[model samples]
Target: MITEVAQIEVLPGHEDQFEQAVSQAVPLFLGAEGCEEVDLQRSTEQPGRYRLLVRWETIEHHTDLFRQSQGYQRWRALAGPHFAAPPQVEHLYSVLAP
Candidate 1:
């Protein structure tokens, strides 16, 4: 599986609104074809910062499939406005060896 981590920065003082929007938008990820799981975490030190973790069957599932779907559009519509800037995203995988 591949894990997609998105660093989201909310506008100053908009943390609460951003969180609410993301909560309502969670289903967009949950209902996607190749998404296995999704989670959102807020930074204690920086209230406006959030980290979104999404596990997918493959990288393509996120980059090619989900990004190209209408769900992506809905996701943006739900929470995009609260963003201070575009989320910075990266993909990761578990290492078999230490």
Candidate 2:
């Protein structure tokens, strides 16, 4: 599996609302084919910052399939308004798993 890590930044004063939006948006992430798991975490040091982790069966499942689906559009509609800027995303794999 591959992991997609998204560095999310909410607009100032919209932290709480952004979290709420994420709660409602999670289903869209899970609804995609090959999506294994989704996790959202807030940064204590940065009130408006969050990290979103999504595990996928393959990179293409997220980069192509999910990104091209209607669910993605819906997700953006629900959470896009809370964003401070475009999120920075990176894909990762376990290199030292035992």
What is the per-residue lDDT of model 1 for residues 1-98, given as tens digits with 9 covering 90 to 100?
99999999999988888888888878889899899998999999988899999999999999999999999999999889899999999999998875
Task: Give the range of the ten consecutive residues with the poorest summed lDDT in model 1.
Answer: 16-25
TM for every model, in the order presented, reads 0.94, 0.96
What residue runs in model 2 are displaced by over 4 Å at the alpha carbon?
A: none
Candidate 1 error regions (>4 Å): none
- The window of 10 residues in a row where model 2 has the poorest summed lDDT is 16-25
Clashes of each: 0, 0
Candidate 2 Cα RMSD after full superposition onto the native fold (Å): 0.8
- Candidate 2: C-alpha lDDT: 0.93
What RMSD value applies to candidate 1? Answer: 1.4
Please report the candidate that would top lDDT against the real structure: 2
Error of 2 at 82 (Å): 0.7
